[model samples]
Target: MRERSVEHEGRPADPDKRTLRLQLLTVRNRLTADDIEEAGAALAGWALKLPELARARTVAAYVSVGSEPATRALLDALHARGVRVLLPALLPDQDLDWGAYAGEGSLTQVRHAGRMTLREPAGDRLGPQAVTGADVVLLPGLAVDAHGMRLGRGGGSYDRVLARLERADAHPALVVLLYDSEVVERLPAQEHDRPVHAVVTPSGVRRFRTG
Candidate 1:
């Protein structure tokens, strides 16, 4: 099948993902606080209905920062269900380490050099490899195409996470969280870019067939 493309403001589609990322970020940065809250609640409602998440014994997720689709509700929901929720803690090298989410109270604000501050789990660190134990991994991305290809911020953190999973032969359900507008028709992909199994938006869920 041919790759699809999403038109921006009736303008021609840009094949360069960097340009697209900037456009998407511009739109996201415009979101109001109320808009973020409503989208977060709706996203949580839709995401919690996913079988992958519902049946998951352990979920690897992140705390949403800035204008990203809010994941606080979903994280708390998973915790309330008695599921083991693992949140990522950024290492000095821009890689991620795992930590258990105890609740909203369990998170601590961490500022990293040359990066946006993050809200990370305050519990003991669980080593980077702990993600291999998750039944589902919720990834943070700027956008996802119809083909499930994700466009992430330049940081190579999740790329490392995916590579580690491959090395360990782990097959967790990989999911991306985004806004409805961020679910586009296509995105430029590199050889190292991994297709996600599904994406959860405020409106609904979209799954792709993956090998």
Candidate 2:
């Protein structure tokens, strides 16, 4: 079946995931522009302090959209640090291609068919395998539990990226950026689910045990 069909399923239609995503998205949608801006700045600051990003030579990340945490600041900061930042360009099949982020001017608004508009790179496509070369991969997620389990937006794009990382034996540090409230007590996980190494929120950073 299609990926959108399982967006709420959270793997086998788990009610826990459905409820958690709904709750998280609702809060995100209600966030005021100022709330999002302030949170984004705070998250950028905390993420910059990460030892992983400081030491990273190549990082794979995505741009934030709508009421999501402000990633533009963080993205600019990383680029200014002379870090090689790779942004994703979604393919037609819901897979992602890689591209270099030069600056705000390098991005173009893309209205994907039957999906939301995304600010993607207006540059060359480096193909999906480019992610294997990254030392760090910043993921976009709704919530993450203590065990590092992430509740994604149900597009299954990141899911495919995770699987690709596994197949390539790419052990880059996986990190999720979120708001303080998104860090919850628990999140249900599945057998195929992979754990993230760290989460950077507006308040602070939290590390988890992952293998």
Candidate 3:
């Protein structure tokens, strides 16, 4: 995509980050239901075989909404294997509080900010610190570059999640789920940004040395 540098006449215009996010969102919105389904199944095939997930006793993952690559199959597969799965519940401050995933029926639709509804766990909230015990953390992102820098939806929620893990000295295998097309050559990075350990796409898994 071309870099957007033009500024609006009357306003202090858009930054490169905002421009990139809009571009990626447009691409994501173009994905069809069938495309998402196929990618989700393929992603499960690649992700389930990873050693990190296979060895994980506790996992932190999320439910995919809208045009994002589906995580329903992968989530179910993890739960079926008796893995302790944790899903995030959005807090008023935009930080995440985790809860145990009981099953498909255990999730409830929670409307947040009057913008989007999230499928969150219906059980008790485990607090934000709960994720510190996870062996692996599956992140939702718009794209991940070769350097494992993830382009999130600009909510800054996961940024806090990563920060919490860091403050706790937790070292879980951080992974991002995306479609093959979302694996890009490069992405803009900020100082607060953290690198992921791997990215699981529809085609395969790409590992990175985050140390």
Candidate 4:
């Protein structure tokens, strides 16, 4: 498949990360359904090529909402492959708890008062520590830097997830899925930031160093 390499303009490493995040989100909000569908299909194809996912017994992943790069394709693909896919359920404090992904029907739309609606598992709740068992984790992000620092929606949910993994000494191969244009030159660093091991974009898969 031919990949579109339209680099996003005005993508500076702005010290005010909020500005950079909004810039990326604004562009993503403009994507058409066709654009999202095509990107989703290509992303699934490219991500499945990764051995981390293929060999994983358990994978921690999230469902994409709205104009973000769709994740339903990848979620279904992973479940179909017999991998125990765990999806997140948001806690009142913004930390993530997990639940199994049986299929599309297993998810329910959950609306947090001040947050985007998330499709969470309709089944039993697995504690936050359940993520420690995952062999790989597919994170949702608006952008990732050349250094693999992921620019999440600024909710700080994944920050907690990453910290939990660190505290527990769980070394899952963390991966971010994004549109090709969202991979940028740099991102403003945060004291609590953690790097990912890989990123799967519409164009291809990229490996990064993570400590």
Q: Kindly give the number of clashing pairs for every candidate.
A: 0, 0, 0, 0
Q: What is the C-alpha lDDT of each candidate?
A: 0.85, 0.87, 0.86, 0.84
Q: What is the lDDT of residue 100 in candidate 4?
A: 98
The best-first sequence of candidates by TM-score reads 2, 3, 1, 4
Q: What alpha-carbon RMSD in Å does predicted model 4 have with respect to the real structure?
A: 6.5
lDDT of 1 by residue, 1-211 (tens): 0011233223344459768878998999999988998899999999899998889999999888888888889999999999999999888766789899989899999877655678888889999999999999999888999899998875678878998999999999999989999988988887777999999999999999877
Candidate 3 residue lDDT tens string, 1-211:
0011222123343376678878888988998999999999999999999999999999999989888899999999999999999999888767789999978898999887645788999999999999999999999988899999988877678888899999999999999999888889988887788999999999999998787
Best-matching candidate per lDDT: 2
Structure candidate 4, residue pairs in collision: none
Q: Which pairs of residues have clashing backbones in candidate 1? A: none
After superposition, candidate 1 runs with Cα above 4 Å error: 1-15
Q: How well does candidate 4 score on lDDT at residue 150?
A: 89
Q: Candidate 3 local accuracy as lDDT?
A: 0.86
Per-residue error (Å), model 2, residue 92: 1.5
**Order of the predicted models by lDDT, top scorer first:** 2, 3, 1, 4
Query: Which whole-number lDDT from 0 to 100 does residue 10 have in model 4?
Result: 25
lDDT for model 2, on a 0 to 1 scale?
0.87
Tell me the tens digit of each residue's lDDT in model 2 across 54-102: 9999999999988789999999999999999999988877888989999
Q: Per-candidate TM vs. native? A: 0.92, 0.94, 0.92, 0.91
Estimate candidate 4's alpha-carbon lDDT, on a 0 to 1 scale: 0.84
